[model samples]
Target: MKKEIIIKHLGVVLLLNGVFLFISFLISFFLNESSTVALLFSALICGIFGVFPLIFVERTEHISFNEGLTIVVLGWIITCVVGMLPYLMWGGEFTLTNAWFESVSGFTTTGSTILTEIESLPKGILFWRSSTHWIGGIGVILFVLLILPRSKGQRITIYNTEISSLSKMNFRYNTRKIVHILAVVYISLTLLETIALMVFGMNFFDAINHSFATIATGGFSTKNLSIAEYNNLGIEVIIMVFMILSGNHFGLIYGTIMLKKENLFRSSLARTFVSVLLIGVLLVTLKLYLSGTYDLLTSLRYASFQVISLGTTTGFATVDTIHWPIFTQIILIYFTIQCAMSGSTSGGLKFDRVYIFFKLLGKQIKLLKHPNSVFVSKFDGKRIDEKLEEQTLVFIVLYVAVFFATTIILTAMDIDGMTAFSASIATLGNVGPGFENVSSLGNFASLPDFGKFVLSVNMLLGRLEIFNILALIMIKK
Candidate 1:
């Protein structure tokens, strides 16, 4: 492995983060907030470390697969480390573990937080938190790739490592084009959402922050009650629409906007994804209404927002779902486990895998009935190769095993069964808010430090995709 190449690429990642940190510092400086010095020092540290590599190591036109993987993995780890600096320096409820947990949650777009009083944070700190989502939403490495001029080989190598095979399914373009599509869609959505939120009475700062969280599907709300604080139906409706859009395949979204043949309406996967979300909404809404939790309209309103939020893995909550009926909770849990589509910002056992799993199951049953019959599974008119099928099944099993292992570990720490189980899946799925102690309205501050650490690892695993990390390990061995 070319260690220098890895360092050089990783430097770019740091510089990208440094740029955001500087912006955050400006926010603090302008507001004369307490975090100004901390943000400035953190940004300087990132700049010094980031620039040191470029000055010493000459740029390379290419990097090997292993080098690319190392850069991608290390980029995230290092980014998280640097991400925690401002928080640690600013001080407050941020202990060492709490800072690490919040940083990981933000970068992973997991949205799980350990802070008990979120509203007390400085505006600069809050913007930095949301900035982490926007940065990590498309991916840190991809941003680096965008600015790395003429390094096609390096770009493709790192792009492949950063993006999953499933995510690439809808992206017919080459690496550069795919990266551009992601940036365009990501930026455009953030801008449009910011405008919409502003139109609905949110201040400029709040609008941009929420837009960042919403577009990234990372639910770090400025208010303690999240979207509930607004109490504006228009804001909720706008967020819900963007959440669902953010959860779909970005390539398909780009296609739809470009009026291409493979637009959202034309893709079966996209159609089914929306359909499933609607069905979940219907089920949860009915349960909420029938159980007298709310009137029909009220139930639909709250239920639709909650279902879409968790269904998209955005984690922005309109209501405290912990008090809802067990049936409704179960439905939400299902969405938590079966997260958003593959190519979108949301993570975990992607809906594509779940969609394929059932399709493959049906195919197997059909083959069983007719012993010699040939059965091939397909999605969106594309054939699912046998190897890809095997890989997806293995990934699902491994994903399940990892979460189960986490749940066991959490439970062993004396955490309750519901909290442990829900926290495990929620983190592993990068869906944020769990039940019980970590309910939609509740934070993860109550968990022991070690328990928070374990969930943070889960967040990274989900964000990186289990296979990527495991493959990197295998390569190391």
Candidate 2:
């Protein structure tokens, strides 16, 4: 492994983070918030550390898979650590553990926060918080790769590490084009959402912040009540629309917008994803209405938003779902585990794997009836590779095992069963909020420090995908 290459690439990532931190510093300076010095010092620290590596390390044309894995994993750890500086320095509700938790949650786009009084923070700090989501939404390495003047081989190697294998299945483009498509789609959605929110009566700052959270599917709302603070139905509808779009494959969105041949309309998986979400909405809405929790119209509105929000892994809340029927909560939990599509901003056990898992099961059933018959599982008209199938199955099993273990740990830490289980799934799925204590409108301030650390690890595992971390460990060994 070329240690210098890894260091150099990580330096690039830090420099990119420095750029965002500098932007936040400017925001603080303009607003005259107390966080001005904090943001500036953080930016300088990033810049100094980032530049130091570049000063010594020479450019390389290629990186081995092991080196790429190291760079990606270590890069994320370094970025998360640096991201906490401003929060720590600002020092309101941010203790060392809380800062680390919030920072990891931000960069991983987990949306699980520890801030008890979110709105009490200054505008600059709040912008910095949302900026972490946007920066992390596409991934730190991806942003670095986009800007780095590197060999195609080097770019492709790192890109492979940054992007999920399942997400790459739909793309026909080369690595360069794939990178471009991701950036273009990400920026376009954020810009469009910002404009739409402003038109729907949100002020400029809040609109842009919400737009960042929405497009990234990060769910860091500017207000304490999340979308519920804005009682406008139009705003809710707009956010819901974008949340659903953001959950699907960004390449498909780009293709659809560009009138390409294989767009969302032509993709079977996209159709199924949307269809399942619609079914979830129907079930939840019906339960809410029948339970006399809300009128039909009100139930539809809240159910639709929460279902889509959590379904997409965005984690924004339009209502406190803790008070909802147990049936509706279970349905939402199903979506939380299923998560959004691959190639999207959202993370966790992607819906693609769930879809594949069911198809794989059906294939097995067919084979049982005729011993000599060969059954092939197909996705989007392509024969699924047996190797990929095995990996997906193992991934699902490992995902469940990890979260189950986490739930047990949290429960042993004296958290209630529901809260512990839901928290495990929420953080492991990179979906924010759980039932009971960590409800839709609730924060994660009450969990023990050890539990918070465990969940932070869960966030990284979900964001990086389980196999990458396992592969890294295996490679290191």
Candidate 3:
């Protein structure tokens, strides 16, 4: 498995994480905050462990698929482990379990929080939290691939393991170009959002942190009320715009910006994703309005924002969704299951798979009626092969099974049915927030320790797209 090579690659990820931690330390130092020592110690630990591996291991020209998969999975685990250090050391509400949960949630871009009062955290710690999202958004391995020199074959191996097959369907470039495109698009969006938020009266610090969370679609807001605290339509609009864009495939975004033929407008999947989100918004808006939850304008605003936020798996909330009508809650839950496009930062059973599942269902119905006739499934004007179709179907079943199993476990722990089921879907989708107890404004602190750990696993499964972890388990077996 080239264990040394895997460790060496992980060292690079650790180095990158150390760089962010050092920056956070500087922030803490400047602010004279109590977290300064914690950040420094964490950074030092990362640097030491990170540099030691490089010293013992030499470079390899090629990495096998199994090796690459191991590195990606282990890299994320290591990143999350290191991520918890600062929180654990700082010593407030962060217990060992809480630190791990919050760290995993951040790196997975799940946006779920164990902290009851987010605003009480020090500025540096908060920045570190948001930084984890930005790093994890494109993936730690991807960022390392960009900066480090590696053979094309080696890069391709890791790239394939890290990114989903469905996501790669839109990319026509080599692995190197794909990495470049991701980096450029990610950085550009983050920078632009920071500026836009600053222009809209957000302070520079908050602007940058929120921009990191927004562009990453990670949903780790600096405020306790999330986007609701601002209550500024302009800021909300800007965030919503970025959230939508971030949920679409980054390759498509780059294509559109560069005026390429394969842009978002031309992509069928992209069109479907946007259309579904809009429909969700409309349905939820109507339900909210009819239920007398809010006036038309207010309902539209909040509904649009919440629907897009959860639909995109960004999870930024402008209102407490628990008080909303049951109809609206169901609509939101549907979006939580049918997440944004595959290539985007959003995770879960992607809309592409859901779209394919429906198309497959229709094909099955046609076959049932026509008995002797043949029917084929197609997407984006191309014929879908039976293998990919089968894979999609299996993925959906597995996704449902995992979430349902999680729900059962949580319920066995004495959690309410609604909280357990919604929490399962929310965590499994890597979409933060749930209904009833774990609603938009509520926190995960009330959940039992074992429940938090199970949800953390769910977050990892969602972010890694389930199969990767399954493949890892098979490899181990």
lDDT of 3 at 63: 68
Q: How does candidate 3 score on lDDT?
A: 0.87
lDDT winner, 1 or 3: 1
Location of the lowest summed lDDT over 10 successive residues in candidate 2: 155-164
Q: Write the per-residue lDDT of candidate 3 for residues 109-139, one digit (tens) a residue.
A: 8899999888999999999999989888977
Please give, for residues 211-303, the per-residue lDDT of candidate 2 as tens digits. 988888889988899999989999999999999999998888888999987689988889999999999999998999999999999999999
Off by over 4 Å in 2: 144-167
TM-score for candidate 1: 0.96
Clashing pairs for model 2 are none
In order, candidate lDDTs are: 0.88, 0.88, 0.87
What is the lDDT, from 0 to 100, of the residue 77 in candidate 2?
A: 93
lDDT tens string, model 1, 1-477? 878888887888889899999999999999999999999999999999999999999987765667767777888999999999999999999999999999999999999998888899999999999999988887743564553343433434334434445556667776688788888898999999999999999999999999999988899998999999889999999999999999998888999999988789988888998999999999999999999999999999998999899989999988898899999999999999999887788878888888878989999899889979888887766787787678789989999999999999999999999999999999999999999999998899999999999999999999888877887898799
* Candidate 2, residue 44: lDDT: 99
